[model samples]
Target: IRDFPTLMTKARICDEDGKAKSSYYKAMNDKKGKGLDRGKPYENKGNGN
Candidate 1:
């Protein structure tokens, strides 16, 4: 949940029309565990730093 803002910001960098930003919020607020607030710890899929 806390990362949503940063995610939206990064998304906006790729999509300047704000489409990704809007969708991101929608997904985060979505019901069930399908949203960003799925109550799971974030996993870093990137290379371990």
Candidate 2:
């Protein structure tokens, strides 16, 4: 599950403003295979030079 629930299960007690919780869910869905995240970062798609 990409270590999501591992954190969300504690979000209720960790995040007071719920900002971290929201971002976590967004990241889980937006992130693709190979651990590639293209949402907040638009530069990680390097050609591996």
The best candidate in terms of TM-score: 2
lDDT of 2 at 40: 42
Off by over 4 Å in 1: 1-17, 31-49
Write down the TM-score of every candidate. 0.29, 0.30
Model 2 superposed RMSD (Cα): 14.8
Candidate 2 per-residue lDDT over residues 1-49, each given as its tens digit: 3698778867756666588779888898876454544354545577573
Error of 2 at 46 (Å): 30
| lDDT, each prediction | 0.71, 0.68
Of candidate 2, the 10-residue stretch with the lowest lDDT total is 32-41
For residues 22-45, write the lDDT of model 1, one tens digit per residue: 887887877547666555465655
